[model samples]
Target: MSDCDDRALIEAAQKDPLAFGALYERYVDRIYNYIFHRVGNVYDAEDLTSRTFFRALSHLADYQDQGYPFSAWLYRIAHNLVANWHRDRSRRPVIALDEIVARSLSEQHPEVVTEARATMRLLREIIRTLDPVRQELLVLKFAEGLSNAEIGKILGRSEGAIKSLYHRTLLQLREEMEKRERGER
Candidate 1:
């Protein structure tokens, strides 16, 4: 959606529930995927996505345009909520095993599926160790498929900074994987 359309929806968001509904429909899937990638759990991601929208609607009066896109504001809200979740949690890694898919895939190609799942788990564990900014960057860039400029706006950074961070993050992940492969971790 264009900035013009977002502005209209945002203005009506405070007064018209239907307008807010439109905004929710536009962003819910992206927001949910973002949360899902960060939290790595379907249920928590669902709950957090619900909370993010609920909080947005609850605080509609507080949102000002400030020349930023409506999505930037939503992303800030989501980022803050996810940060708070990380802070408040007791710190356990919870993995969502898609059992139905895994089961069927295993039946078809047991070894390949098992190796892929193991690699996925390893990668997730490595990602979970990174700082929150890098983690959010990855989620926003890949999961949301946001452009660097867009991510910069949501992250309050310059596009160059986002690019630099992205480069470093990739290198860090690659190094970690290499170490693991060499049995050095």
Candidate 2:
């Protein structure tokens, strides 16, 4: 949807809770996928996704455009909730292998699937080792397919900063993967 369409939806939703359902329908999958990646499980993802929408609905009246997409506001809520979830658990993040495998199963042969799964597992492990901000950056940039500008809005960084961080992140991932390969040898 265009920014204008989203803005209209937000305005309508703010005036009527029922209108918020349209906004929810537009964003639920994206938000759920994002939460699912962060929490690594369906149950927690579902819980957090619900919490995100509820919070958004409750605060809809307070929302101001600020020129960013509505998704940015929703993402900020998800990010804060995920942060608290990790802090409360005192554990490193995990990406569920089954979820990854399931998503890829339809398109690849078994052998290719195995290789892809292994690669994704390694990447996820490396990603978990990153600071939360960097991890969030990767998820937003790659997993969610957000543009650098969109990621910057959600991450509270400049678009240039997001570009630079993405470059550095790829370098770090490459270095980490090399270290892992050398150790395996």
Measured with C-alpha atoms, the lDDT of residue 57 in candidate 2 is 95
lDDT, candidate 2, at 103: 80
In candidate 1, what are the lDDT values of residues 1-185, reduced to their tens digit? Answer: 89998888888877776678999999999999888877778889999999999999988988888988889988898888887888799574354645644776776577888887777777777887888899889989988999999999999999999999999999999999888879897
> Which residues of candidate 1, in runs, are more than 4 Å off?
92-108
What is each predicted model's overall lDDT from 0 to 1? Answer: 0.85, 0.89
Which predicted model would earn the best TM-score?
2
Clash count, one per candidate: 0, 0
> If candidate 1 were superposed on the true structure by all CA atoms, what would the RMSD be?
2.2
Q: Which parts of model 2 have CA positions greater than 4 angstroms off?
A: 102-112
